[model samples]
Structures are given as structure tokens and as C-alpha cells.
Target chain A: MARIVGSIMSTHVPSIAGAMSRHAEGEPYWKPFFDGYEPVRAWLDEVRPDVAVVVHNDHGLNFFLDKMPTFAVGCAPQYLHADEGWGIPEVEPFPGDPQLSWHLVESLIGEEFDLTTCQEMLVDHAVTNPMQLCWPDPDDRAAIRIVPVTVNTVMFPYPSARRCYALGEAIGRAITSYDAEEDLKVVLMGTGGLSHQLEGRRAGFINKEFDLRFLESLTEEPAWATQYSGEDLVRLTGSQGVELLMWLTARAALLGGARKVTSNYHIPISNTAAGTVVLEPAA
Target chain B: MGTGTTRHEIPGTTIFDGAEAQKGYALNKMCFSFNDGTNRAAFLDDEEAYCHRYGLSDDQTKAIRDRDVLRLLELGGHPYYLAKFAGIFRLDVQDLGALQTGLSKEEFQARLVAAGR
Candidate 1:
């Protein structure tokens, strides 16, 4: 049986790449964001998940406005990171576990969630940043494999919050049922906002109140988080904050309940508030 | 591609939904090309020729000429792809914030700091 070891929710703000590449450790402006992921490294050490079901959104790298899917799961043998403009140095290709990726595609389809399955494509910052943050060292990254799940947060009319929740549930069911040798341990990771808009007059908007409330609701009353509409999401959190819905999928995967391990929230990571949470199943 | 849009009732935000994706396809394709440095230089060298090469509609051509974020949004330019176009002009997405809010860049930066407070 496949076992979901835990879930890690994070912010994939691209600038972190520059900060890390530039060795911004001692720099006060970038320290908090870098420091924020320290615990994730420890947690990854402790959990040692066999695979990560990384849920992230694209930034016009893979699917242009041309053919964006509501949800896409990559089943390729390897997914290379792309130069997201400004030429962020490409990292080594992320290893993929096709068996599990296919398992998810088959199971999710059986559960009535139509997801685009990609055999070939490169991932952008959203997926790579979290990996870089949690396991910053290259050798550490090679130890584990990934099943990249891309969500639609870039374009408008997001997958309803309820649907995101249900999708998580389906993902949970799928992972728990995959008959793998030696009981594969899994980690479900969700990336994107806490608050802070990237466009429009209301841009630069960071509702820390709403960000905290969102984190609280997601960690506690997850069902209630599902009740929010897209407008309400934007009204409460900001335009980009609607990306929090991606977190719902991971929250739903915690077979028991989100036994919050630890969480961090910080503001102004290039026009966004960054948040991270580590959740394990309650006894 | 935009057909699966969840339903956009968010006011003041023109979502790049399926209809918008279909409408702004050519414009976005042009912007997406900006991911390559040479392509960006090409656009900078001959903006009209670049737009024409991508089969940009007249409105999109005008929007590119004007560097109008709002007009591009009206033309179905998805925020992410549009950011690439804005990048060519050395304008970050935050620049769009200042542009939309009718504030200076520092003023916009202050507003972001203010909101967090």
C-alpha cells in the first residue's frame, strides 16, 4: 500500500531562486524567507518520503494561454526546470516516478476528475522553488522522486474551492490505494499564495489578516475553507491569494487530520506574502 | 484551453478565462516568446514587425505599441504572459500595480508595506 507520510505547503515566489543563487543568506532582506525553509529540511530528513506529489501552478512556461489545463499531472521520466526569463540557471532534471504518476492519473480519472497527463514537458519556478527550498542541496533532491501536479491559478475562474478539496480527497484515495512494493511513503506538496496581489490597482495588496485566517481555516476548519467563492477569495486574500485553494488539495490528503507541525508567514517577497506549513496525520 | 474556467465573478479583475484565452491567443503567444532573450531583443529592435510576425490583431498591436496593461487585459492577455511583455520594457508586475493604481513606483511600494501593516 502507498502511505502518505505528510504534506508541505509553501510559497513559490521566483525571486528566492536569485537570492539562493546570489547566496543571500546573510542579507537581512532575504534571510527570513531563506530561514523559513530550515524546518522543512529537517522534516524532509525525518519523513524521508519516497516520493513527493508536488502541486504547483505554472507561470507561462509549459502551458501558455494556449492550452492550460485545470489540473495537469506529469508522468514523464524526467522534468527539466526551465529558464523562466532572466535566465534562472536550469537545474538538473527532476526525476519522476511514472508508476505512481500513472496510478494517480488512472485513479483520479476513475474518481471523475479529468486531468491532463503529460509525458513530456519542463516545469517552471512553482515546482522547482519548493524543491530547492526544502532540499536546497542537489544531492538531497536526487534521493527522492516527484509527481508534478500543476493547478490552474494563473488564469481566472479557478477550480472551485470545493472541487480543489475534493480533488485532494481523490488524490488521498489514489495514493493510499496504489499497491507499491515495500509500502511507498508519499508527501503531498502545495505551492502558491498566502496573500499579496501581483497586478491591478489593488496590487501590492497583502491581507495578513486574511492570510492568517486562511492558514487557520485550512489547518483547522478545512471544510469551511471550501465554502469561499473566487470573488470572496480575492476580496479576502487578494487576486493571487486565490492560489491558496491549491493548499486545500494537500489538506484533504491528510487521511486523519492536519496535525499542524509548524508554520511560518512573512510579507513582501516581491509583491507576495510567503507562508509554509508542515502537517502530519493526527493519531 | 480557457473553457474549464471555474466561473469568474471577481469584480475589477478581467480573468484570462477560456474565452479570453481564445481571444488573446495571438497576443499571448507573442508575449510568451519573450521568454527567450533574443526574441525580446527582436521585439525591441522592430516592435511592429515582431507583433506582425505573431499575427497580433490590430488592437493587440496597438496595446503593445501603447504598453497598455489594461488594454492588453481587455484583449485577453493573461497576467503571467503579459508580465513577459512588460518585462521587455523593464517593467515588473509591480509596475502594473502602480500603473493601475495611478501611483508612483515608490508610492505603490509604500502601499504594499502599508497593507502588510
Candidate 2:
């Protein structure tokens, strides 16, 4: 049977790509953010997950307004990164775990959560940046395969925190029940926010109070955030900041309560509040 | 609540719901095209023609021509797709933030950093 080793909730701000491309991690402005990953890298070295189930939202790189699905899973053998029109150099393609993706799709649908399954999907910065953050070395990245699970955070009418949590539970059920030849170690990755908006007059909005509380809730009281409505989340976290739904879903995927391993928070990572948290299932 | 029935207002923010989507379709369509280098180059070559091809509303066209970030949002532009449009002019989110808030880039950045403390 396959098993989830742990889960990672991270910020996928696009500008982080430029900072990395310039190798500016040691620069004064980016040092704090980069330094946060040290412990995360150490944890990864210890756990050594064979596959990563990345839960993120696409930022206009794959699905568009033409047709949007509330939830989509990629079953492609290879997922490529493309130009986001912002001139950030595209990263290498991610090798996909199609078998696990299909298993997730079948189990999730069986669990009554309808999802769109794609055999071809273009991964945007949201997927690419965090992958790079986790495995800074290409060789380390090569060892792990990926299964991309995207939620509709780019537009309004988003799935509720509670609904996303339930989806995560279904994902956990699927992964735990997956019958495979070898025992597979999987890491659940939730990539997005910690309060920051980028539109209207509140373009640079960052709610530290809400972010800290939300971060605390992830482990201390996992479902604490599900109490708020989508509008409430946007009002409290900012438009793009509401991307924390990704965090909730990933956290919920841990069958048992989670134990916080390491966490980091910083402001104004390219008009967004950037954060990262690692949680392993409680023993 | 996940139910999509009710609507609530968030000051200084526009929820890109169904109505906003309908209103900004053409403008966002044009912006989404920027994901391709050739389309970005074509838009740079003739902004008006590209806007015309996308059937952008006169207001949206003027907003795009003026590079008015706030006006584009008012005209129903989503930040995600509008970002690609901003890319054509080499504007990052910080630049967009400054423009929308009527602050200098440095001032806007300072405001963000201050949010942490």
C-alpha cells in the first residue's frame, strides 16, 4: 500500500522565480525567505518522498476563462512549463505519476467529488516555483515524480474551505488505499498564500494578524478556517491571499492530526504574503 | 459557505464572479493571449489592432492604452490575466500595486514590508 509521508504548504509567488534565476537567495532582500527553506530541505533529505502530490492553483498558464473546472487532476506522463509572459525562464518539465493520478481520480470520484482529469496540462509558476524551492538541486528533483491537483482559486465562486478539506480527505483515503507493487512514499504539497491581495486599491494588502492565526490553525485547530465564507476569506486575507484554500486542502489530506515540523512567513514576495509550512501526520 | 448564491462586498476589491467574467471576457481574452510570445509581440507592434481583434470595449481599449491598472479592474479585468497584459510593458506586481494605490513604487513596497511588523 502507498502512504503519505508528510505534507508541505508553501507560497508560490511568481517573482520568487526571478530571484532564484538571478541566484539572489543570498542577497539581503531575499535572504530571509531563502533561509527559511534550509530546515525544509533537511526534512526532505530525511523523509525522501518518492512522489509529490502538488495541490496548487494555475495562474493563467493552463485553463483559462473559456472553460474552468472547480477541480482538476493531471494524469499526464510529462508536464511542461511554459512562458507566463513575464519573461521568467521556464524550468525543466516534471515527470508525472500517471498511475497515482488515475488512482486518485477514480477514488475521489468514487468518494463523490467530481473532478476534471487532464492527460495534457501545462504547469505554470504556481507548480514550478515551489517544486524548485523544495528540490533546489535538479538531481534531487529528478528522483521524485509529481501529480498535479489544481483547485479553482484564480476566479471567484471558489470551492469552500470545508469542501476543499473534504476533497483532501478523499485524496488521503485514495493514497492510503492505493495498492501497488512497492510501497510508495508520497508528499502532499499545498502551494499558495499567507494573506496578500493584488487588485483594486488594496493591491498590496497583507493581513499578518489573519495569516498568523491561520498558520496556527493549520495544526492546533485544522478546520478553524472553514468557518469563514469565501467572501469573508477574501476580505480577511485579500483576493490572492485566499489562495490559502490550497493550504487547508493539503493539511486536511493528512488522515490523522498533523505535527508541525517547520514554518516560515514573510511579507511582500512580489505583492503577496509568502509562507511555507511542513506538517507530518501525527503518530 | 460554499454556496454561490449571496454576494458580499469587499472594499478595495472586486470579486471576479460570473457577472465580472461576462463583462471582462474580451479584455481578458486579449490579455490571456500574451502567454504566447508571438501574440505579445503582435500586441506590441499594434496595440489598437490587437485590441480590435479581441473586440475589446472602447473603455477597455482606452484603459489598456493608458495602462491604467485600476481602470482595467473597474472594467472587470482579473489580476491573473491582467498580469500577462502588464508583462507586455515590463510591469511587475509591485508596479501594478503602486499604480493602483497611487503610491510611488518604493512607498508601496514600504507599505508591504510594514505589514509584517
Candidate 3:
């Protein structure tokens, strides 16, 4: 049976990629951010998860406003680079694990989690930025398989934090029920958040305290984390707080009482808290 | 070739009024800012300066500028951003037109929902 070896929650600020590229050699603005993820990079190296089920939100890529699915799972063999304006820089197209993705989708729906499946989809920075950051490619790195899941946080009346959490629990159940005989270790990665507004006069505001508390709740008391509605979150932490649902979902997928392996928090990441936390099942 | 007279006589010709055009400009500006690292950095450095440079109003300069989205739908009618805007506002497609195009919102949403959008 497939087992979830661990879960990771990381903020998907597009600048993270820019930071990594700049910091790989060493740049001032991004050095601190890159430093924070070193431990996370080490953990990923040590665990060496076979597949990563990434949960993120698309910024109008794939299922644009015409029809936004609350949760869409990628069942495609490969996903193309989205022309999200200027487009991605020097990155290879992402490879998808359709078999495992479909299995998880079927298993989740069978477990009562309604999932919208996509055969062809393009992923935006939300998925790519974190992937580039967490798994910086080696000289001849083996490709890492991905199962991309999207949440509807881009639109209003988005699924509540509770719903995302429930989906995560369902994902955990789905993975647990997989009939595969291989020693599959999957990593549940939640990308997006720790407080920065993307719109209006309050656009560049950052709530450091709220971000810290959110990271605390995410690791120590995730159940309490889902009580906040999107509106409540926006009011407290600006509209970007909506991304917190991704973290809650990651938390829900973990085995209860997992040990947090690495936690890092940095502020003013181009006007946001670039926070990350990795949790692993208790040994 | 189509006659200029017929094109000029098209109804809703004034749909792209000054306000509507401004909204489209704002939306494009935001899209540009999102795409360009230098622009985004300048905007982050000083929002007021960025707005002044872009020639956008204070309301037009907000971070999550959905008004521009609404305006783009009104003027140009790009389904891509409209769909996203509709999803963002949770506004039914039909209702969006009825509200902006003088159609009944319910009927518009119904048509869109029926069309599988």
C-alpha cells in the first residue's frame, strides 16, 4: 500500500524562484529566503519521496473563471508550461503521474471526496515555483513525478478552509487504500500562503504576527486552523490569506501526531512572509 | 471589406466609454505588472510611485484589482478573465451580463450554466 511519508507547506511567492536563481550563486535580497529552505532541502534529500502530490491554486491558468472546480486533480501524462503572461524561464515542462493521480482521484471519490479530474492542464507559478525551490535540479537529476491538485481559492465563495482539510483527509485515506505493491512513499505538498495581499491599496501589506500564528496553528493545532472563513482570513491577513487553505489541506493529510521536521519563517519577502514547515509521520 | 458606416453604426458603440477604456487599461497594467519582474519590484518598492508611473487612480491601483477585470469583461468581453472574475466575485455569468449588459442576471447565469461554463 502507498504511504504518505510526509507533508510540506511552503509559501508560493513567485519571487521564490527568482530568489533561488539569484541565490544559487548568491544574491542579497534572496539570501535569507534561500537560507531558510536549506534544512527543508536536506529533509527532502533524506526522505527522497517517490512522488509528490502537490496542492495549489492556479492564477487563471487551466480552469479559468468560466468554470472553476472546487478541487481539480491532474490525470494527464504531462502538463505544459502555462503562458501566464511573460511565461516561465528556462524550465522544462512538468511530468505527471497519471496512473497514481487517477488512482488517488478514484479512491478519493470512492471515499466521498468529489474531485474534478483533468486530462490536459497547464500549471502556473503556484505549482512550479515551489517545485523549483524544493527540488532544485542536480546536474543529471532524475525527474520527480507529480500529482497536481488545485483548489478554488482564486474565486470568491471558495471552498472553506474546512472543506480543504476534509479533502486532505480524504487524500490520506485514498493513498492508504492504494493496492500497489511497490514501496511508494508519497509527499503531500501544500503551496501558497503566509500573508500578503495581492490587490487594492492594501496590496503590499504584510501581517507578520498573523503569519507566525498561522504557522504555529498549522503545525501544532491544525483543527483550530480551519475555523476561519475566507472573508475572516482576508480581513485579518489580507486577501492572500485565502491561500492558507492549501496548508490546512496539507495538515489534514498527515498521520495524526506527526513530528515537524523543519520550520522556517521570514518576513517582507517582497511584501509577504515566506514561511515553510515540513512534517513527517512519527517514526 | 465591411463599410465603415456599418461599423460605426453598431449598437453599444459607446460601451467602450472613457471609464470602460480606463478599466481595460488598468487590467492590462495589472497583467503587465504580474508578468514583469522589474515592474512588480518597482510596484512593491513604492505603490504610490508605481501608480503615478502607471497613471492609474488610487482605486485602480489596489493590489487585487477586480474592477479592471469587471471593466475588461464589459468592454472587450474576454471570457478567460471574465470567467475568473465571475468565479472570484461568485457572480453568475448571466447575472454579470444582466448587471452590465442590461440582460437579466438570472437568465444569463442560467444560459452559462446550461452551456457548461
On lDDT, the candidate that comes out on top is 2
**DockQ of each model vs. true complex:** 0.54, 0.81, 0.05
In candidate 3 chain A, what residue range of length 10 has the lowest lDDT sum? A197-206
For candidate 3, what is the total of clashing residue pairs? 15
The model with the greatest DockQ is: 2
DockQ, 0 to 1 scale, candidate 3: 0.05
**i-RMS for every candidate:** 2.1, 0.9, 17.5
Candidate 3 structure quality by residue, lDDT tens digits, A1-283: 7899899888877556555665552566566677777898898888787888999988766664446688999999877764454333535677788889989888888877778899998887788888877888832123677889999875555788888888998888888777777988899999988876543323344567677777777656877767876666777666665688888888899857678888887664544667788998767
**For every candidate, what share of the true interface contacts is present?**
0.54, 0.82, 0.06
Runs in model 2 deviating more than 4 A are: B1-6
Model 2 / residue A43 / CA error / Å: 0.7
Error of 3 at A6 (Å): 0.8
Residue B76, candidate 3: C-alpha displacement in angstroms: 12
How well does candidate 2 match the true structure in TM-score terms? 0.98
